[model samples]
Target chain A: MKIALAQISPILQDVRKNINRHLKLAEKAKKERADLIVFPELSLTGYTLQDLVPEAAINPNKDDSFDAFRLISKEISIVLGFVEEKGKGSFYNSAAFISGGEVLHIHRKVFLPTYGMFDEAKFFSQGKDISAFQTPFGKTGLLICYDFLNYGANYVLFSQGADIIIALSAAPGRGINENDAFASSHMWELMGETVSRFSTAFVIYCNRVGFEDGKSFAGGSFIYSPEGTAICRASYIDEDFLIEELDLSLLRKARQKLMYKRDNKPEVILKNLYRAVFKNED
Target chain B: MKINTVFVERILTKFIKDELGKFHFKKAVLGLSGGLDSSVTAFLCAKAIGAENVLAIIMPYGESIKKDISDAKKVVKQLGINSKTIHINPMVDAYYSKYPIQNRVIKGNKMARERMSILYDFSSREKAMVIGTSNKTELLLGYGTIHGDMASGINPIGDLYKTQVRQLGKHLGIPEEILKKSPSAGFWPGQTDEKEIGIDYENIDNILYQIVDLRKQKKEVAAMGFSQKTIDRLVEMIKNSEFKRKLPLIPKISERTVGHDFLLPYDWGK
Candidate 1:
């Protein structure tokens, strides 16, 4: 099936404008005959809302903004980002997997960056559970921007029988100059390699672009093939899309490659250790 | 404009050097503009590393004031820095002729990026890291360009407000010409930063330090007797430029990231 990666330019704090941009891009993807189109993290509310998040957080069940996405999901599945409020003051920066005019799954961001240019933990609670949902396209796993850093997170989804890994990231970073002295792309390189190696499924990375507050986003959104090759790359500093077709046949082959070690080793011993350490007499 | 000298020597300067040293970098490069921000950065770099290791480049275009050029020279001389004069008029004009940019914002941004390109190239050639001159006020307001004046390997003055940059300027014995000159990005022929932004450095710095540095909300800023428009505009600027302060997008394949994927310092040892 053809999937469209919506690498969008989100206006800071302007949820309405950003949602409109998302709708426009979804329409554009549908016109290109895409079965599913996914947007960057927090595509509706925009990243870097800071304290304004409390005012902009949406309760998805009551959100009219999501209706625009839900309506389009009838013809083409769409994934988009927005904030979800929970338990009074706590919130989650989340993505929804929508298809056939209904919300299928919502994945809250698991990792919240708290240093350098980020303080997500100051605003958002860490997501507890990973999601694997069945769709017409394939068995897809959901992860917000930082959730990809946990290799075990991908391992769990893959082991649980996921055929596609859709990662929505508001990945923050700087651009590289060919002549610049410093090699600062270390973290980004590592993250990219990790995604391809573990999941061995179609990995879709959707990133936001443009300047917000003092932080400028380096928009290098791309798709990694099951073999870890970057099949399509979005343009830097602009809104773009990389629509491609995926073959589930390759995913099955990848799973078969890792099947041998799936049952062998440490989890058996760990389960017994857990039972021994915390035996309940009551 | 009083500052704790102990903080400068013990914390800020040492932190600046330590950050550079962590990357195995030994020297710092500054595009000494004879303006308050650049002068302050030059001063801090000298103190952080040493006068000998601090390389200052006096970049002057054709339309630049002779006094500013002399003032930049004076800063380097006083700081006893390793200095170079690279006249950029030929390069800038040559590129502008070929590109012929009509939009002022785009042109200014390109010029800033071009300046950064030169600085980065020189930084590589000199084996030094480019030190940033943007202050907290500029950064918060989106007052600088990305990959141009906004880009740096390390920024010694990014946290300081523009007003505080001046205070640090005085502590570093920056010449009165640079210390007292009106703030400008020096992008165009007659562009003053205040004239463009419609706010003075003093007010911008005060509001920024309160709203951003002190974590005071917009209402709190208004209650401090500032105009509501000023507070709103400053808050908007801060919110708008938030993306400029982060890392490039990395797809979350792992459970954590340096960004939305994980949270940790680059220097955090494994």
Candidate 2:
């Protein structure tokens, strides 16, 4: 199956522009005969809304904001990030898995990072369960940023038979370096390592590029094979599309060669890792 | 100004070992670029948790130049921290070979990202938290890379402005060469940050303080006699790059979360 990673630059707080950009990228992905196109986290309304999040929230079922994407997804699976109204007063930062002109499933972000400049907890609600969507391609798992750092629940999606993992993120700030220049791609490397080591499936990461909120995102969108080798990578600091063919057989072969499994966790060893690292508390 | 090394060291020690020490992190890893940012960051980490507790990785690619390595070594010698130099030239060169790049701007960015890849590997292997080196000026201007140089376990100098960083550097008793050298991202040998950005640090430091953190409007800035173009650019940077100041927002579905619902600190348990 061919998957397209959309590394797009979205205009903050401008839903129409963001939706338009998604539509264009989705079309571009379709033109390339991609079976699936993944986008960055909250690409519809840039990541730094804070109190403005309420104004930016849209209901996928009723908002009509996703109609274009839904129509475009008829050609291929589209996983684009947006805000979804949950209850009467609450909302979720979500990614809609649209296939065949329908909103197939929605995966709300599980981890809401609040440290440093991140104020997501002030605006968003967390998701409880791991979600996998059924596409014409395969059972695909959807996760937003922050959760990318936590693979425990993500592993659950794989155990449930997800053959592909797509992560959408708008990770800001730099890493250990001076400027926010190198952190996003490095984090992608870490993500690739983790996903390959655990699930042994096709892992696709789509990150936002350009400066949004005083933080510049490096695109570096890519596809990692089950063997942990990079299949295709997008450019940095510019909007680009990376379309690549993924072999399902490779995943099966890699999994068979794997020694450890998440399901077969040794209680003592698990306890020791957490206890030694986390120490006291519990 | 009489630099009070003892006084500053006392505060930093308390923050690094005693206060942040509450986490009982196994180790702290810093990217020693041999530049001002990394040098200052390494010194702060060494002081915060002792030399033995801090791990410094000198990541250099082909474009990193020889001066960078020597400067990194000088900082290591001065601080007496645990250090290792790893050349990423082969890995990055191979990466670019696969995805050939033409533009210098794009290549520079790739270099930064490649260097970060090495830093993270060392970070995980050593079981250390990555410390950030971005100052307030760079953070305000969206001058950094997301997840590359920006993704840190914790940032100690994030709140300090450029001038304040220099002040703190002097107070921390960092080496003269490190404190005196012209600031550069070290992406290309001749490419300095000021040249790329088209503004010097001194002017940017003063203007950013008056505007961003201070919340002064354009008129107020103009009244300060700064050019309209500079003020306009600064404000545009601050306003347009606002997304740089957040976590990748999650659509809230749960009752509690860090960015959406709970809004608590990472060390809230403490």
Give a tens-digit lDDT track for model 1, residues A1-282. Answer: 888988775765677777787788888889999999988888887787766677778877876877877888999999888888876777899889999988999988887888866789887878888878898878889887778777767776766666678888787554222322112233544565566656576777777764454344556677776656667777654567788887757766766775522553447655765787799522
How high is each candidate's TM-score?
0.53, 0.52
Residue B83 alpha-carbon offset, candidate 2, angstroms = 46
What C-alpha lDDT values do all the predictions have?
A: 0.74, 0.74
TM-score winner: 1
Task: Name the runs in model 2 displaced over 4 angstroms.
Answer: A176-181, A259-281, B1-270
**Global fold similarity of model 1 (TM-score):** 0.53
Q: In model 2 chain A, which range of ten residues has the least summed lDDT?
A: A173-182
Question: What DockQ does each prediction reach against the true complex?
Answer: 0.03, 0.02
**Candidate 1 ranges with C-alpha deviation above 4 Å:** A87-89, A174-186, A256-282, B1-270
The fraction of correct interface contacts reproduced by each prediction comes to 0.00, 0.00
TM-score of chain B of each: 0.89, 0.89
DockQ of 2: 0.02
RMSD of 1: 18.9
lDDT of 2 at B1: 20
Docking class of 2: incorrect
